[model samples]
Target chain A: MNRLFGNRTAIAFLVLPGVAIMVFALIVPIGFSFYFSLTDWAGFGAFNPVGAANYKEILTADPVFWRSLVNALILMAVTIFIQNPVAFALAALLAHISQKASQIFRSIFFVPAVLSVVVITKLWVNIFNPTYGILNKLLRLAGLKSLAVSWLSNPHTALGSVIWIIIWQGFGWALLFYYTGLMTVPKEIEEAAVVDGASWPQTYTRIILPYMFPVISSVIVIDVISSLKQMEMIYLSTDGGPGQLTQFIAVYLYQKAFVASQYGYGNALSILFVVVAVGITVLVQRLFRSEGEIQ
Target chain B: MNALTKTPLFDRSAGKRFGKFALYAFLVVFAILQVFPLLWVFDYSIQKTGDLFGPELIKLPLVPVWHNYARAWVDGKILRYFINSSIVVVSSVLISTVVSFCLAYATTRMVWKLRTLAAGFIGLGMVIPIHTTLLPNFIWFNVFGLINTHVGLIIPYIAFTLSFNTLLFAGQLKTLPRSMEESAFLDGARYPKILASVIAPMAAPAIVTVLVMTFLTNWNEFIMANTYLSTDDLRTLPFSIIRFQGQYSSDYAVQFACMTLVALPPLVLYFFFSRWIMSGATAGAVKG
Candidate 1:
């Protein structure tokens, strides 16, 4: 039995394939990415080694890089603050309603999240269209013509518009998480809190939110990572347009490498992207860690 | 029960009643905001391209221009892209799930050296976003002559998905009783036999969860497909709508139709398999 279970050939066949795929697809590429980052290769034959020059420029000289990094932070803040609170409140409201209504509303809200990112982005792009979009059209119909600005093209509104698309799609998932967490909160706790003459807000703040700390923190951690890594919606919607006002790290690196053909410089940007993603993920997880969370 | 009856669940005071009314009002408005945009998409998909220019919120064509669907399918290149998407997503989901199942079983059930480290390495892949590898992969696929091919795209899709897939399988496989496999082994059932008959049936739900998650990620994946595959035949579903929008810039109805076609399958899939996705996703979230 031991031989059968621990058979070296069996273990080798099973584990190595997955490990090999990961190493080839993930680990080895990062190695190549690092190697390429040291050079000034512009996607062609000969290239001189520029060791950290790209990094230096990106850190000190590059305004776009800073803009991208700041945008990610802004996204993280918006998701954690604006998105979560609203989703949590909506979820609380959903919980109060009958089960049937809650299910219907939940499913309806999640439709955008479940749709393809391309579809969602395109859908919103059409809605925000200055000329023919329903949003501007409706505003004009309501005699609010001045309010119907070009959402994606305008410098002031571009970042907010892209961020809105991201938030709108992700809002449902946030609500679902909070709702699920609320569901697991024991009914008896609320009953006890109320029996002690605690007001509704007091019961939620002390009893419920404390119990929901894990769910909330985990959601926040996900928000931080996703915010940093977000590229698809921004890429499809704005491509970091309006004087790079909407640039995020992923999209910025993509344009630099592929569009500008500054392959080496883009590689440098990507390494920094990974650093930020991992650093923030770890920091947030640490903040949320309480008894036994850390392995 | 007795304690609950004294205070009751929700207060019945006038202020509390007003509060409930306000909550309902907020929820209904939010629900409308959520569904209204989607309804507009359907509405516009049937309207004439000329009619779509109007400021009317809801416009119905005298005769619905159902031909937009045909144009999207034929002229927009959606059919081919849809096939490409299915091929890539299915191949990635199938291969990754099997690969992950093998690793999950090996690390969790069977004995091995450095098993925890192996599992950890696999799990670490989750954090490795595709952007990090985009340029390197572009160069790598360039050298290997894998560019613009479905295989090139599927390779990374499978690679990125393995971590989460393995996590799900490992979570489910760890909780399953070894007694089933052990008893089967006593009957001289080999690894393949035991896995197919004993392990797999038990992990079926998780397999579905992994399948759904992997499928959705690959199906909606835009950047990698956009980066790796440049040719028309190799374009995936997401790009079909984007490309259609660009090529037929003024054909708003056709663009909306293309978007609907791109969205329909996943919407249908969600409708049927939502319970599986919801329960599995929440469990995964809490555990993570």
Candidate 2:
């Protein structure tokens, strides 16, 4: 078995193809991104190197870059704080319900997650249209015409509206994760808590939560990365409009590169993006690690 | 474990009964919030255009404008884009599944140096954002003249999926006992033969799980497709919606039809394979 399994030729054939693809598709492009980010390439003709100028402009000078960063932070906070806890509570509730009902609710909730992001974004954009949207129509019926503002266009509501759409689409995935995590908890733990006179809510808060630390942390980690990677929804809906209030890093990078035709600057933006993404990933993992130690 | 909720302990009082009622009420309302948009799109897909002023939230049209679907299929070019999406999704899913299966087997089962290093390098692909590669990939595609072609989109789609699928596959493959393969070797069965007939069958469910996942991700992928596939004919299904939303800005019903058409496959796949999809999701999160 050892000789057969360890055949060098066979192992090379099996592994090399997949590894080559990753190196070509992932590593090589990053290498190119770093190399070209130094030069002032305009997607075409001759250009000279302008080392660190793009990075300097982004870090210290660009207001939109900062705005996009702040927006991403806000999104991360909402997803981690609001979306997750609520989903966890719902999963707790679903765990208590009948199996049939739980299955049905799980399927319904996961529909948006399975649907295309474009579908959800465009649907919300339509639903927020001021003239004929169902939202404003319903608001007027309730005699609150002032509240029936253009959700995606108005300054005060634009960021909130875009964030709501992002949260709406993501809610299902969080619910699924929590629900699945809840399923893994032993029944005796809960029953033992109940026998000890702890109420269901108290049991969940004190015992079940600590048990679910790893799953909960993983969910938050996913929420964090996805929040940072947010682009398609904002791009389709607001395009970070209403004076760039809804800008995010990924979409901003794309707009700089492809839309604005600043290839070199875009590469710089992308390199910075990798740095920040890697940085936050490390930070979040360490945060969770230390918290896990406390637990 | 939650049988505790239904027993005499928790279900005894009227207050607890009221609480359960309230819980159902909340769950029902949230479910409505989750599914209402899709139902609204379906309802309005058949309703007449220019009826946006109606007070009702949704209505079944007395005369359904089913031709809106025809218009979306032909004039909206959803048919063309759907075929384009199929080519990209199918090619990528097939390649990713087969390659990851092989990669997983070699890394997990074979005795080789650099196995851990190779596996670790590919695993890093999971955390890296696709945006990091977008600009350079665009330049490379331009250089190779793969831009605006299905092959261009399919190649990268296969790459992005390799790491996740390989991890999931490796996690599953590691669980199986090696005794079967050892016995097969005693019977003079070749390594490839044992792997093909034994390992593949054992990991069949995981293979399906990763296949569905790769298919969904590739199907809904828009950024790479939008950046690379610039021509109308070559664009994928999700990419066409941006164009349709603009061109038929006033033709809301037809656009609704277009949205519904683009969303149908994944929706159908999810419901049809909900069992595999759900378990696979949990397993991937836990293990991969």
Candidate 3:
């Protein structure tokens, strides 16, 4: 009896604060979101329940929602195909260098990773500005003035430019992961491959890439999640402008709820957004199953 | 031995040295591309508009203006925003760390079904987005009359991130042997005492990492803060920066100055904790 009492009291003390906060702050809000999604609430007045209409409208009629989804998918594809390959190559190069050089370059590469998103977005936006910006100025100077354009404002290029900025900021992190993973590769494996007359490219393709599968999968998963949740850079640079060319789900939903005053519809969009994000994350994890194979 | 004695392909010789030189040259060019904007921002912060752009727009700021920093800090309302940000971040850190430490300890040490249920429930929080819950909470806060306050913002922010923090901390705590706590129990120490006196010190590095992550999230957070905070005085750095843009539309110098002020604190703090930040980032990714 004493042991039970002692343990129960101890457990209560340990958990009560976190539980209280999580229930009120996290669980309750989500519950409220569900309840509100079934209503006609405009965020500042009397309201009534209008169940499931919001979801139907968003699913059937909302062009912006579909556009945001497509943009996010395009961004994800670019990140996985272009960014990861470049990052992997750089990481391999870093692994081959001397310690002093590697350390210096590692810090240099990581500056973008550690910088605030606000600074990075503003920096790139300025660089890509159409008039009086350095990019245009340089293009003109080099007799390539025809190429310069308003990168963030042009409908044709805005999404690509915004996606490029996100990948540029995130490049260092992917590089860092691959570099760190490469550092942990046992030297003996490389030596054995060498002794067997394996070339450098073959060693990397056959032996090293297999060993680094877990890291690669993790980075891919992160990229997928970040792609689905990308709001800040898009919001800052373009604000889903030029007719929502650069729209992402996170920013789009916020605009609906706050700006468009369609609170219930926004909530429905958000719930669907969550389902897609979680669904993609789980799918990626299962597809890889590289975790168990990694020793 | 004879085969091993043949010239090594990856020799530390002239060819390799030249190859290294090529690699360094590539890295230097990339570094310049990466750092160019930041250097421009810094240089622009000191100059007038005339010096900013020219036929040769790449020239360094002709006359440095130190007043931009002073004006940004004073008139731009950055100080107020900084204080507001600190209030939310510090309070969130202190509250989350204490609550999570206790919860993590219970989840690891308790052999009870309730503990299992509690941890399981928290795990669902990992995937829930803030947008999904924002409207409902906004409605609730209006009824409770808690809207536009630091407390209102802190509550949801901490709640939203608690699961991941608990999972990180609890995984680390579980790695410690149970015998240490059992011995403490045998010697007549209480659970809180064991956590306070024993577990915390050893788990210091992990705790620090969690704190850094929490700080970064809070510092960079804009969505919740923008929604919840209606008062100018309660706005965070990000919110204030947006306002700064509107207020100084054409003065690119002052706008860049505001950005400099906004970017400096986190940059300086990151430099100090660069190693820990890298380790924390890698560990979180690898462990996940």
Pairs that collide in candidate 3 are none
lDDT digits (tens) for residues A4-83 of candidate 3: 32488788888888888878876777677778789877766888899899988888998999999999899999999999
> Taking the tens digit of each residue's C-alpha lDDT, what string does model 2 give over B242-276?
77767887888888888898889999999888877
TM-score of chain B of each: 0.90, 0.91, 0.90
**Number of the predicted model whose TM-score against the real structure is largest:** 2
Give candidate 1's whole-model lDDT. 0.87
Q: Please tell me what DockQ candidate 2 reaches.
A: 0.63
Who wins the DockQ comparison?
2
Q: Which residue pairs show backbone clashes in model 1?
A: none
Model 1 misses residue B172 by how many Å?
A: 1.9
How do the residues B1-288 of candidate 3 rate in per-residue lDDT, one tens digit apiece? 688557666667857788878998988887787677888888888877556666786877656787787877776798899999999999997788778888888887676778778988776676666666666788787777778999998888788767778877887898898777777778888777888998899789878877887777678787788788899888888764577677777877777788888888777877777776676677656666
By DockQ rank, best first, the candidates go: 2, 1, 3
lDDT by residue for model 1 (B1-288), tens:
588667665657756878878887888889888777777888899888888787586687668889999998998788788889999999999999999999889988988778888877887786777899998988877778888899999899989988878878888888987788778988989888888888999999998988897888889998899889889888998887878766899999999999888889999999998877776666656666
DockQ, all candidates in order: 0.62, 0.63, 0.49
Off by over 4 Å in 3: A1-6, A290-295, B1-12, B114-117
TM-score (all chains, Cα) for each model: 0.94, 0.95, 0.93
